[model samples]
Target: MFDPDEIRGMLISAAQQRMALTYSEVLHALGHRFTRPLMRQLCKVLDAIDEDGRAAGEPGLAVLVVRQSDGLPGQGWFVARSGSHADLPLDWEGTEARRYVEARQGEAFDYWATR
Candidate 1:
């Protein structure tokens, strides 16, 4: 089974490195689908991470964990018809979206930290 925690960790690592990965990879890692609410929540998480100044290295993993609790898009991971830059096969998809999430992931803390 795909573990969200593990996926979050990878994103966090990518954030710390300030490197970006494919959005499809992120979805694959989480075993999720591309849905509207999921996309919104993911965006919200990124916004929250930035607002909280957790968009930097190493510490943003907490944000990922918290945001992850919002849940995956669906049962299986999402598929992108074209490149990662394509519409996410959903709307609101962007080239930087994946990187943005990664940056936030690195600053995440324990789930309790969010509460």
Candidate 2:
């Protein structure tokens, strides 16, 4: 069984350390290498974490997990945003996308970096 809290704790630790982790880095932290199944399950757990955080009025933790090349969350994060991401552009590309992503990531860092 996947321990969501374990992953949550790792994300929190990353926030505490004030840094974003690549998907592979997160998997390695959990003692697993990169795999499609693990990545999917990890995204599911991260979505749940974001939901719980939203309920508690906290920044999304999943923003801290991102692509290694671009340092941006995967497409799932954008697609899952019902209306909470209205501020972001529709196309979700270029400087606008980078600013939006960095803002969200900054929220997570600022919220948890000192806590």
Best model number under TM-score:
2
lDDT for each residue of candidate 1 in 15-38, tens digit (9 for 90 to 100): 555444544446555667755566
lDDT of 2 at 97: 71
Q: How does each model score on lDDT?
A: 0.41, 0.84
TM-scores for the candidates: 0.34, 0.90
Model 1 segments more than 4 A misplaced: 1-8, 54-115
Clashing pairs in 2: none
Number of clashes in model 2? Answer: 0
By summed lDDT, the worst window of 10 consecutive residues in model 1 runs over: 73-82
lDDT of 2 by residue, 11-114 (tens): 88888888889999989878899998998888998999999999999999998899888888887777777477668656555677788888988898898977
